[model samples]
Target: LRIIKTVPCLSRADLADSFVLQASKEKKCPDTDYLSENGICCDQCPKGYKLIEQCHAPGQRSNCTPCPTDQYMENRNFYPNCRSCKRCKRNEIPVTPCQPTQNTICQCVKDYYKFDIDGDTYECRKCKQCGVDEKEKQSCTPESNTVCECKEKYYRFKNKCEPCERQGSSFFKSTMGNSLPVCLTLFLWESKVSIFYTVIRRHATGQWSKQTVNYCTHFYLSLSAPHSHLSIPPAALSDLLYTVLDLVPIQKVKQLVRSLGVTDTEIAQAEMDNRYCREAHYQMLRVWAERKSLAGVGGQGELFDCSLMQELLDKLRKMDLGLAVQELETKYGTL
Candidate 1:
């Protein structure tokens, strides 16, 4: 092979021209270069040695011994010697093809990605399961990850899928998202658009409160005569009263009672007289009174008026209706 020599004071173009002059006419020289000291060469570093520095002259040393495992050179060179390779980062595997002349390339395990996806190179992504309904149905891939979701029978809590606990309720993907609600909680029956709320019972304390429902719709609310009548004795009124106090805020009760002409003093007396009512009643009164700046001392002193009674009855009807469905399903399997 013909060689071109690089000399001092000669531009690369001039050297090429001179080498072409000395070449055979039939050689048809495509390209040539002068080997320079401390300069990178076209060939890779030989085994057991690495190019740490390059030669600028034709006869200067253009090769260096391999760097020790502890040191490595940062760039290609034919110099004194290569630096030691850097230690791999935690949980990172270095590419074996890299050498002292090139910086180390580290990659994380398959389970980890750089900042999940579309993240910075220094970050790592982790694997996670899908939502409850999709626990056995969904998965993740390297390029894209699965979104947490609620399965057909499961609901979501804090982005985690949880099984629907309320009987007669199941996870359903509504326009809003996957949620657990009573199957027919909002349905049209007999030309009446009925909506329902839930009351979660405290097994140990027997206390009840309205379990929030995501979807709220208008209902043709009505209360049965028996549930609306406070004259039936407090024992018979416990469940009905519990249901009422749970669903309607005290401010709403006050408004309904005021509409019936019941004085705040009477409201206060009824609260004090009822032994079975929970402390939640006072909590409601305090919040409502503080909010409305109503100085009147109605602590359930007087019974709620007939309309308030009607609200209680309507709430109970929904609860009882739900309970009936749950009972039937339990006896005969899901219906």
Candidate 2:
């Protein structure tokens, strides 16, 4: 028995496991304390306070101090310094002021919604207001935006709410060779050129109307015609302006107006005159339109005209605002 008491050789893995088991058996700091650099279990700094120095020995409290002004320590932590509090941005208001143990909470101001950029940061965006032809389906809230729908007897056509035409009005009807009444709508194309075509057929009930027919086809044909010098109707032009405002981003409004020859002083004046961002943008566009009209056509008192619209579209194209141009063409018929 004393001859061969050979010891079992330990592998590197076995040594590592034995060390890990020994480490696991060591006493861990309690929830209220943290392991300090000197291998001591130190009491954690309480909420509203930060650690100034670690405890010198086991079962001892760390040196701590209250968070400074505009700073916070939200939890029991052993951090060396407190976190700085956040400030509310423009169009935002503080919902809850910062306290030593808590951070400030912020929310969007009235008529604005919170727009998150990264997950940790956000800004406020102006809430959308429904147009005259649309009705509010859902009210705006801080977390969500307004929802709009076309009003009664109005339908969405090319992203705008247009009134449904009455029967036997706004278009001429003539009999074709097949005895079907062909609806003839005169559409004014660019540069005052007229495009006349039969776009709709009379229903079996003998009642035909623009709304009841394939109005989209008529719209396509009208816009697809060759360019001419036709002036857009005043109402249509107004709608186009609104549509342009909707299509152009709020951030890019200043750049757009500047490119369209609006001076910095005028832009600043518009900002002073209008409190809301949307109103300021609309006012700037109005100023740009009036100035362009005056310079191009000797101030006919028309804020918008065919030539002005063409020039605007050209400017937008040059500025790489193709979405606005495409939307304008889709909604109001092409220039």
TM-score of each: 0.28, 0.45
lDDT (0 to 1) per candidate:
0.41, 0.68
Q: Count backbone overlaps in model 1.
A: 38
Question: 174-222, model 2: which lDDT tens digit per residue?
Answer: 6768775666555433423222334554678997644343222212122
Q: Where is model 2 poorest over a 10-residue stretch in terms of lDDT?
A: 213-222
Best by lDDT: 2
**Mind giving the per-residue lDDT tens digits that candidate 1 earns over 1-335?**
99999857989888877675545333431132223322322333444456655554444444467776655666444345555555555555675646644656666556643332111224434645543355443344433233333445444333344444442432322332444333324322222222334434344577644453433232222323543312223333344344545544434555534443456776677577666445535433433323222222243222323233334333322332223222322321221
lDDT of 2: 0.68
Question: Model 2: runs farther than 4 Å from truth?
Answer: 1-25, 166-335
